[model samples]
Structure formats: structure tokens, C-alpha cells
Target: MRHVLLSLGILLILTVSSLTAQVPRRSFLFKDARGELAQARARGEMDVLLVIASMPDQNEQVAQAIAGLGGTVQFQADEVDYIRARVPVDGVEELVSHSAVHSVDISITGSRAFGMAADAPVLPNSEDFSASGILSEAVNPDTIIWPPVLSDYPITNRYSPLFDIRASEFLDSNPTYDGRGVKIAMIDMNPDPLLPELQVATDLDGQPIRKIGVYGTAQDLEEEDDGRWIRMEDMVTAADGQFTYGDNTYVAPKDGTFRIALFHEARDSLATFGGSLENDVNRDGNPEGSSRLFGVLWDEETDDVWVDTNQDLSFADQTALTDYNDRPEFGVFGTDDPDTPIRESVAFGIQIAQEKKLIALNLGSASHATLVVGAALANRGSEGRFDGVAPGAQLISIAEGGSAYGQIESPLISIRDHGAEVVYFEQSSNITRNYLLRDGRLVPTVIYERLIDRYDPVILSPTHNYPILGGIDDFVMARGLIGINGHESKENFFINHGVRVEHDDNLLITGGYGPMGNGALKPDVISPSNYVSTALGFIEGRA
Candidate 1:
């Protein structure tokens, strides 16, 4: 009797709701724009706008109209029928009034999507377990937790088991899908090529994965130093002419020849001195040398350390690293400018190695790139433990110019030409909180959609790290884009009942919200990110 009354009441409400339904009303704004673009007119401001044309023929007319409004076309993609330009915010309505303009959206300003928390440290393991492959149970090393904490330093290529990527389980289920032979392109700031984790000795199929192509300045490693900076005061010589500092022992080159590098802190974060290890120390203009170990040689004259910048084995001919002011014409401290300023802190690192190098050069600026790439394809670490999501995929690195805008087109084209099956670009518009323009369009979304239709590569983008904003980043708002959100894991430190405990799985507070402004479900998936212990190629300030 109660159920019947409820059903009758629900039917009555539904019939009344249907009878009183409101008619759909047309929007007051232009078909091509959102309210924000329209509101810009009242403020008399300027903004970067991505204008898409209805037809290819009107591209020229659109360009002319932009020029007439004292606007400059920053990027023109005639092939795609779009142009990105900076026009007066007040003049947006005039530009939209043109018959050929199909849609007007906000342009993106790029920001690296990576960040690091210095307060939380990932420590090394107490023992090296016997493990050698991606499928091995001991792949992620067991960390030490006694004596309060063992060491704060992160281990290179040490993938944390707590931040489970489920690669082993997924591989076990399929057995054949390890991204073998797939070309995965990464476009970020410079990544260290010689990092052992990035290199492949032998993959799961007994094949060696390799970089098919590398774009941008041919990876001028010669200009880049090879090792991390070691403070001069920390160098202590052992009986065998080996250098020992803290827990690190650096063996000298077996052949007695060494290339010493002295780096001074500089004003603009540029190294005071750096040169390719490939320099012909024999003065033969050839790349053959018998140096194995890099050692620090104290200079008596300048009371400062010196580098063999002149390629002579002897340190006599080199000037004091502090004498950059006198060598203005000679490109001091790796800078072509004559006026590079030096800071008080001076550090040095070994640049040449006959066998295996010691500490790898840590590009602190490139940490973001390292994190993203490590999450994707870092091979098993030196211990033969730990593996990335797809350790068998062939890598192609496309470095981008350091700018917020107007630099990614070349990299995109390069990746497309290389036949990349997966493309991961480590950039997001964190500053521009707007995920969907009022008209429900993101510039990257449109561009990526066209690229997907033409080339067919899986694109992965991050839901920006602001959950309060309640939407994914602009790039991930559209179809065919995988928006990844961050989730917490057991590895992250937390306090529970007056004791430190590893937190369980939960959506990271740093993660963005879903169900986008247009009512579309966003953040296609979530991944562990609170603290992922992966490959950190270089050790910084170890002494």
C-alpha cells in the first residue's frame, strides 16, 4: 500500500514537470565568443585570441582585419584554418563581426606542469634485493625506515613500490603489451641523455631500446658538463690518488690524465665555466684522450680553482676561474656575453671519464622533465630493480625553447614526422585558470583534435594542480585527450596518533576537480604522485 502511494505521487510530479517545461532560449553573446570576450570591450583591454575561420578562403581576410585593428598575428596555421593574434579586447566584437570567423577562444600561455617538494625526502634501501626485470617481485627496492630515517637522498632509478603503477600486473595479464617498438616522443626542457636510466642495455624481448632521433642543437653535450658540482673544500684524497667526499668515492682516470672543471656561481644561474669533455687535450683537434678520472687541482695563484679550458693537460696555462673579467672576448663562464656576473659560492665537477662517470650533471631546471619521463620510461635502476610503465618503448626527445608561448609548433611537427605513437608534452597553462572558454572551447583541445584526426597519436595532459578551480587544464577538456590527476599513496609521510605513518591512497589535495564547466566529466584517470621514488639522475650538494 505504501509503495503504490509513492509510485502515484512520482508519476504526478513527472507529469506536472513535463507540462511546465521551459522553452530553450538562444544565447545573447555572439556565436563565436564567450561573455568574457564580450566583456573585454567595456574595460578597453587587450588579450591574445585564437581565431578559427569558417572556411580556408577567409584566412587572408581575417589576417587583414587583424592587421587593420593594430593587431599582430603571432602564429598562423593556414593549413588548419586558424590564426593566433593579440587584438584589442575592445575590438574583439568587431573582429567577431566578420562573416568568416567561426570561433574565438583564449590562447594558452605555457607553464611546466611539474613540481617538487623539498620537505619530503625519498630515502635509499637498507639492502639490495635480488631482482632483475620488470616482472620481478623485488623490482621496487624495500626502503629503510629504522633509526628514525636512513638517508634523505633519492636513489636514481629506484621506483617506489608504494606508488604502484600496476605495470607488472598489467604486463602479466597481457604478456605482449610492453610498448615494444613504439615511438614515444617527449618535448620538455633539456633532458640528460647519458643518464643510465634513460639508456637501454637489453629490453624484455632481448632487444636494446634506443633513441631513434634527437632534435634541437644535436644534443650538444660537448657544451654541457658531465658531472654534478662538488665543492672544493669537500675534496679529500685517499692513498690511491682517489677522491673521497662524504659517502662518494671518485676514482681517477687509470691513464693519469684528468680534465678538471671549476664552476663558479653566477648571477643569472649560468655556470661560470663549462666545456665539452670531447675537447682535444692532445691539441690534435681529435677526440681521443686517456683520461679516466676527474680530480680537483688547487690553484696557488688566484687562490681559486681552475679548469683546463684550453685543452692542455697541464693546469699552468689556464686562468683563475675568477679572472672572467679579463677574458671578456673569450666567453667567460659558458656565456658569450662579456658581462656575466659571478656569485660568491664556487663549485667544481669532473667533466671527462675514461670508464664510468661518477655523479651525473643535475639540471635542477630540468627536474620537471626528469619526473615526467621517469614516470613513463625509466629503465630498471643500477640494481636491476625498478622499472617504468613501458621500459621497452623507443624514445625520441624533442627539446623546446624556454618560452611560455610561440615555441611548440616545431616540436609538434617533429614528433609527428617521427611517427610517434604517444606524445607527452610537459607543459600546462597553470596561470590561465580558464579551462573552457565561455563558449566551451580550449585552444589546445581544438589543435590536438585536428592532430589526432590526421596523425593518430595518443595525447596525455595533466589536469592542472588546483582542485579548488574544479576543472581540468584547458588541453584535457576536449575529447580524445587523457587528463591525469594525482592521487596520494602509502609512501608519503604523515602523522597518525603521534607516530609517522605512510598515508593510504586518496585523491591528492593538489589534484584538480572534474565535471568541467560545460558539464563534461574531466580527468579521465588518476595516477600516484604524492611522492614517486623514480630515477633522479643527478645528486645535488652531496658533501
Candidate 2:
């Protein structure tokens, strides 16, 4: 329910600064505003807010003044003394005259830009097909019975989202208006060849249905991993005594010792990246029963170094609870006290949590834009559950990996040169920011929102993020009903966070069900999904 994003060095507390001090516009301070205003005007938007930056101590007074001036504040960055608010269109000049104002510009936006840089150093390269999440192997295709024949929930496959919008109906009704002649353009890093269903159809506009193009963006502008996750690759391969482990003690040997590099044997295995301690190296569903983070112990007699799977300084001992205390005389094992939970200790539990947190802060999960395109355009083969709308239509894909101006402009060059009718985007957010190069330095910036003309396919999933919340629920689902370790149930079931308790008898319970905003559009639409396992054939390896 609370923000899971934990930052270490961020101290955003209020601090005083001189009222006369001027804060120069920095790229990180604000989004590209001038360009955004131009887009809003071109798109016919009215009463758009201008994000304002003020002197450190002037934020409060400026906010009150803005409120008095009929402007509603959307966000306030206390550490930076910035305010994003919707000011009156008629009083822009007058509001700019406010003494506390340092800079006034349109509110900018940021996006994941679809994963890491093009030459991403990580193993899951940007071009990896599976990273697209589009061409994933379907677990259930045939003989997997789906949704029961309920009264109101009749057959929905092959005729749901498309039929509701009459695309499929038109396809079945008449070929006259079919997308035979249309030249649709799509951009992605990797695209599956036109599916079998579209193999025969030709476009009426003399354009091929399988048209493809490439757009050039910055190769590796992404500075860090932003996936908010931790994987095996993120772990340190080598161990140093100078570095501290989770127990606040040095991981280093007495003074001159070093632990041999730790390596994840399952680096190439599917379904890894659960951070270290929380990772199920053995895949036994006993994640907390043991830890995967190992230290290297030198086998003096064998003349070899062995991986200490547990943080304990022993060789050839299993990391599981079963063999956790086998080498007690080495002082590396716990007291084997039945009363104390081994997982509760820092070396075993808290340290892993800290490592995982640090890892989540550094990972950059792959983008699924091409994946979305695959779900939207990929035609069904023998593995039938549902077919994308207008399977006969042509497609063009380009990988826009960066948010630079050249990167943003490169696609339009391809679109214009190729003569495209439809464009597909899966960058997650609608708005993207651009840095304005001024004088010689990159200063103020503005973000641009994609404008939907009559032709572009603007598909979106209707889901509000509760990422951490969902992870908690998922953990409970896998482990069973979590018992209350320290609090009440009616209101805050997730109070203790992820501390799990063992119990029998399966039961599903909802937490944070307190009334907030009761009504919202339910049943989000996922163009491509891996829900065949959960919802049967209704969403089988579907996209």
C-alpha cells in the first residue's frame, strides 16, 4: 500500500535558501516544457499546467499564492523547491511576475523508453526475442478447456475486443472494407514474421502486409537498470573483506583475506532474477528455508575454493535448514536453537533483504513494446486461442530504445519514407520529455505526448499500478495463507510486509479493501498476455 521505492541518499526535507537566489533550469529539475506547450496547442488542449520551480524556502508561500490565484497544485518536490500546478491561461504573465518564482514551464513527463540501452551490457540484451514477451512459448494451446459454459459468460475467444469494435465482424462480413490495401507501419527491435493467417492477404493500397523498417536511437543512453528488480547477474562475482555483509560485520577475512567470486549456476536458467537470498536456487518452493547467496571458502587440503552457500564460513555444507548447523564447531553455524528462527538472523535473512533491495534499485527489466505489437498483430497458427485484429494487415517495426530528439525523429523519417498508415507504440507512457539544448548547455526541457489521429492503433491496458502490493499477494498465493505475526487483520493485513507464516487450509483474503475510490473500469485489457496458465484458453499464450 505504501511506496516500495526506497532510496538511500535522497534527503528531500525542506531547507532554507535565500529568496533572491535563482535556480537555473537543469535537465533533471524539470521536463521539456516549451515543446510540451507546443504539443498541447497543436493537440488543442486547454488549461494545461506549467511546472514552476521556486527558491528553496519560497515553495510554501508560492504554493499558497498559486492556490489564491486559482491554480491547483498537482505535485510538490520539497527537496528541489518545485511545484507543478495548473495556472490560469489568462494570467500567465502576471503569475510569472511572482517574486518567489525561479522558472515556469510546462509539466514534463518521463518513461522507461522500453528497457535499457541498445548495447545493454546485461545478459538479457535489448534484442533478445523472449525479452519482448511476445513470442513466449504457450504452455496450453490445445486440449486445455477454458472458461466454463456459464449463463452470461459464453464463448469469448476470437470475437471479444475486436468484435466489440466491429473489426472482426467486418472481417467476417465483407472483404470490401478489409485492411487489404492499407499499409500499416510498426516499429520494434524484433518482430515475428507475419503469422500464418496473414500469409495470403495483400493490401489494397499496393503495400505489403509485412513491411518492416528500422529507426536509429542512442545505443546506451540508459545510465542504470530501472526495472526495480534483482537478478543473479546483478550479484557481485567476487567477495572482498573490505565490503560489509548484511550483518554490519565485514565480509572480509581478518585483514588480508578475500572470498573467491560467487557465481549463480542458474544464470542461464529460465525464471531467475529473484535477487539473492530470496531466490529459489533449488526450485523447491522453499525460498526462505535457505539462501542462495554464497561465500567462497578455501579447501586447504583439497587445494580448492568451495562456495559457502550459506553466509557461514564452512565448506560443503548445504544452505538449507536441514544442514544449516552441521559445522557448529567452526563458529560459522548458528546455535541450532529451535527457539530462534534461522531466517530471522541478519546473516541469513536481513542481509538478503538488504541485498535484494539494492539489486532492485539497479536492475533494468526488458521492455515489452515489441511484445505488445506481437500480441496486437501476430496472427494465430495451430496454437489457437485468439487472433489479432486484421491479421491480414502489413506490419513495420523499429526499435526506439532511447528518448533523444534524434531517436524520436528517426521513426518519423522511416514512417514518411516508407509511407505508413498505422503506427504502434508500447513505450508504456503517453508523454516523453526532450532536453532543450541552450547556448552550449542542456538546460530546461519539455515532454511530448503522442497525438492519436484517426489511424494510429492506440491500444492500452486499463490497470493502475500497485506493483509491490501485487508481489505481496503473489507471494501469499504461492506460499498459502500467511498467518498474522504481529497485528490485526481487518484493515492492514499487509502490515508486517513480507514476513510469511506457515499454515494449512487454503483461504483467499483481500487486504487494503478500505473504501478509497470505489468505482473504476475493471478487467484490464492486456493485448499480449501469459495468462493461459491462470485463465485457461481465454488468454492462452495470447497477445
**What tens digits encode model 2's per-residue C-alpha lDDT throughout 146-254?**
4223222212332233433436667667754545554454433323222233233345754444322221221111221212222322222224434443442333332
Per-residue lDDT for 1-543 in model 1, tens only? Answer: 999999999999998875333212112223224544544455565664443432334677888888888887865666545666777775666776677665455432233122222255766453444444235454453553322322333344343432367666767788557566777777664444434456653445657745323323111122223233333433333345454433445543222333343432221223211222223211223334533223344432333434543323434444433221122111111212222221111122222221322222222224455556666776653532345676667665544433323223533554455677788756534423543442234444445555665677887766664546564566665456677777755444441123354556667654566666566666777876644423323223210
Query: Which residue pairs does candidate 1 place in steric collision?
Result: 157-535, 222-276, 252-293, 253-292, 253-293, 272-333, 292-354
Cα misplacement distance, residue 268 of candidate 1 (Å) = 3.4
Native-referenced Cα lDDT, model 1: 0.46
Task: Pick the TM-score winner.
Answer: 1
Q: Pick the candidate with the highest lDDT.
A: 1
Per-model lDDT: 0.46, 0.34
Q: Estimate each model's TM-score.
A: 0.52, 0.30
